[model samples]
Target: MKKINEITEILGDDTSYYLDHVSKKIPKERLQIPGPESVDNFRESDRSPQVLKNLAQLYNHGNLGGTGYINILPIDQGIEHSAAFSFYKNQDYFDPENIVKLAVEAGCNGVASTFGALALHSRKYAHKIPFVVKINHNELLTYPNKYDQISYGTVKEAWNLGATAIGATIYFGSKQSNRQIQEIAEAFEEAHQLGMATILWCYTRNSEFKTDSDDYHSAADLTGQANHIGVTIKADIIKQKLPTNNFGFREVDFAKYDEEMYESLTTDHPIDLCRLQVANCYMGKIGLINSGGGSKGESDYKEAVRTAIINKRAGGSGLIMGRKAFQRPLKEGVDILESVQSVYLNDKITVA
Candidate 1:
């Protein structure tokens, strides 16, 4: 029934309505920092206007673990692996400014990058987005150790760099774990003095600490146990990798398998299982967030989000991902970050 001219207009011109259609569907967001309206209002006030007061309250001036959820950005891979290996393959990622831009664009609560990166990039966006400088780093190219060492950058330096928090990784089961624990304790005290928070990357890694059998690295039971340790040490937030169903505990109490506790703990699926574990861990005071692992296809990323949705539903802080986020093209990586924010804030993973 269409007219010939209409058909010709649709087919011959190559005109497109796709972009316009997509633009209209986008939800209104906190897209621009100090958005246009806020900037206009700011010019009228000297000390503190009502809008600035509201902005401070919304920005979580003093609250980090309340109902106001947290989404952290971690770009520590450059120190975990080698800079050449971690940043060279995707060379644009080597630039510190791009890292900050990606985090802000993705709508994250805060970004966690190494001290060096933050120092280089803070001048531009420190006032715009919150920053967390990772204090310890073990380089693959240097002296090899079983666990990462506390390296450059101090809590004082992070404060100087305008960081909102300081993060460190402590191998829970390593022989040096106690020393790392001591380091964390010291770091916690210092960060608190500066009115900043502390985040810990806790993992059960040595032969002794991991010998618990039921809980160990990558095991829900162990990860949960590590979460408790992080709380005891006063970490404001904690990070762990996704857990597998593999029971690593040494005990063989088969009779207790079908108990209510066990049944309540078990999840409907792997993603749900991890969620259950994090929920179980929430009994402690500290907040728990899962780390984003290696990069994978979009489907795999979505599944990771499905797992995170389970965590958020049951009670989780948010995500602190590295390679899974910044390793790809900047725009695509940001898209993935937005997907995670969608999961955390909206409790839905169906968003593209």
Candidate 2:
């Protein structure tokens, strides 16, 4: 694998520009963790040793091959977005077995999917790789696309199916936010009691959200607050979207944050925007994994690589790529996933 510095140079101009600026500011030790030797310090917490061991197993697997980072394959989109919409391009994934096969073939650290997808083949593949059962999902099939995540299964069911972790989504800005938070918090508490780690998809979705607005749902400020909530709920890992802009101050009147504070703290670079998001995850005590939004034609691979670089450089836990990998052929998907792993494995890329 090429060094991260060299890899940045080969990327297109846009990627190289951000890398050039951010690379200089990265600390000598980019990947940080708790406990001795980068192992997560969950031993001191209420989590059992088995839970810590399972979490360590996930971080230690995959091409990155260590405990300081992660590269998970989340395939729950089949239920979130309709199956036809998610797997239309790659018909092979229509089979639930193929989804597990893809994660195994690609050597992902873990695979996150719905209860049915993982449970149906749990006897065969659950022991082969770390399984993350998505306990809840929001389907778009409903009229006007309701923003609520109904429980698909119980945490105990996931543990019985040999899941190493349990994941759930919470629409932060929606009317059901309070209820979702309460439900997920209780679920995560139960998951911990069962010796399973927890992952929260801390996403913001509301009808009032405007895509063109600077402080929209995906902005750094709001998403950072979402991460804070995830950590408060005791999520072992927090999955969030990459922050595109800083629109957080507009939503509330509690603090008087000016343009100068935003620029100085987050800067204008995309990587810095992501860095701010990580900063909100209990100051990086909890793992922060960014989502791989959607595919962008021929630029999908390049964009994935760029996202990985930014996430890694900004002190993120890793990437939980879904649609970008599964939408393509298995071989192509594996290649893209490997490229993402390469970014984290490259030792020369420094970020403290």
Q: Which prediction has the highest lDDT against the true structure?
A: 2
Tell me the tens digit of each residue's lDDT in model 1 across 1-352: 1232332233243223211111111111211111113223234433234323333332352122223456677887877876788786578777878788777776677778888888987888777787878898765665554565665778899989887777888876667778988988888778766767678887777554344444446766566667777867767667877776534443333222334554555543444445444444434234567887777655545554544554454445567776767777877777666666555444222111
**Which residue pairs overlap in candidate 1's backbone?**
73-112, 213-248, 213-249, 213-250, 214-249, 215-222
Kindly provide the TM-score of model 2 when superposed on the true structure, using C-alpha atoms: 0.92
Alpha-carbon TM-score of each model against the true structure: 0.72, 0.92
Candidate 1 least-lDDT 10 residues: 18-27
Give each model's whole-structure lDDT. 0.60, 0.80
Candidate 2, residues 69-181, lDDT tens digits: the string is 78889888778888988888998887889888989888898999989999999999888899999999996788977879999888899999999999999999889999999
